[model samples]
Target: MAWTRLLPVADLPVGMARTVRVGLDDVLVCRLDDQRVHVLEDVCSHDDAPLGDQEIEGGCVTCPRHGARFDIESGAVRRSPAPVGIATYPARIQDSWVEADLED
Candidate 1:
């Protein structure tokens, strides 16, 4: 898989979700802690709403449109109203930047 550098780790504050355009996809990036970060698609599975800027609840974020909570790291569905899980990318911190492999 190819890795694309999204943004600097310092720009992503903890507990805040940021949206970045990667190719034709809108990617959601969130930094949970100093050593933990997550990358995923910015769309909700239930109603196609943007998942960006959602508040972090532990390791998950709830869809504002439908209240469907999903794990930001693995994209697993944690609450109802979502029929499926979101898409998560393999992410890593390289050279002080957050990089993600969007090609999957």
Candidate 2:
């Protein structure tokens, strides 16, 4: 797997999310806390709504359109209306930058 640098770790505030384009994919990168970060697809599974602007609470992102909530870390379905979970990517911090494996 190849790790692609998205942005600086310091640029991403804790408990917030940002969208980055890697190749042809629009990835949503969320910083859950000081030490944890999650990368997932930017679209909601059920209605294909964009999740980039959704609010994150309790480690889950609630879809603004239909009220579907999904866990940021594991891409699990936390609340219905989503029906299924989205795709998650492996993320890490290296050289003070946030990186994610886009090969998967």
Candidate 3:
């Protein structure tokens, strides 16, 4: 598997996510519950809006444009208008840094 270093773990706060560029795509990397990190496509499935600019609550991030909600853990579109699912990247914390695998 190919792993790309995204950011230092200190840069990501628990319960929050940040946008990182992987190749030509922007990904939302989330540091969740002090356990695992989740990476989802930054653009919302609805209207192609950016999910990173929206507020994060519980485990979901809402789409700022159309109010579509997405579960960060699974990249599931929990709300409508975003009927399609998002692409997810495997993520982990290694050596005090956050790394994501975009090989898939």
For model 3, residues 1-68, the per-residue Cα lDDT tens digits are 88889999898888788888777978898888667888888998778987774346878888878888
Better of 2 and 3 by lDDT: 2
Better of 1 and 3 by TM-score: 1
Q: What is the lDDT of residue 64 in candidate 1?
A: 85
Query: Which residue pairs collide in model 2, if any?
Result: none
The C-alpha local distance difference test score for the whole of candidate 1 amounts to 0.88
In order, what is each prediction's RMSD in angstroms? 1.1, 1.2, 1.4
Which pairs of residues collide in candidate 1?
none
Question: Residue 44 of candidate 1: its Cα lDDT?
Answer: 94
- Among these predictions, the greatest lDDT belongs to 1
- TM-score of every model? 0.93, 0.92, 0.91
Candidate 3 lDDT (Cα, whole model)?
0.83
Q: Residues 1-104, candidate 1: write the lDDT tens digits.
A: 78899999999888878889877879999889888889999999998998877558888988888789999889999999999999999998889999998886
Off by over 4 Å in 3: 53-55
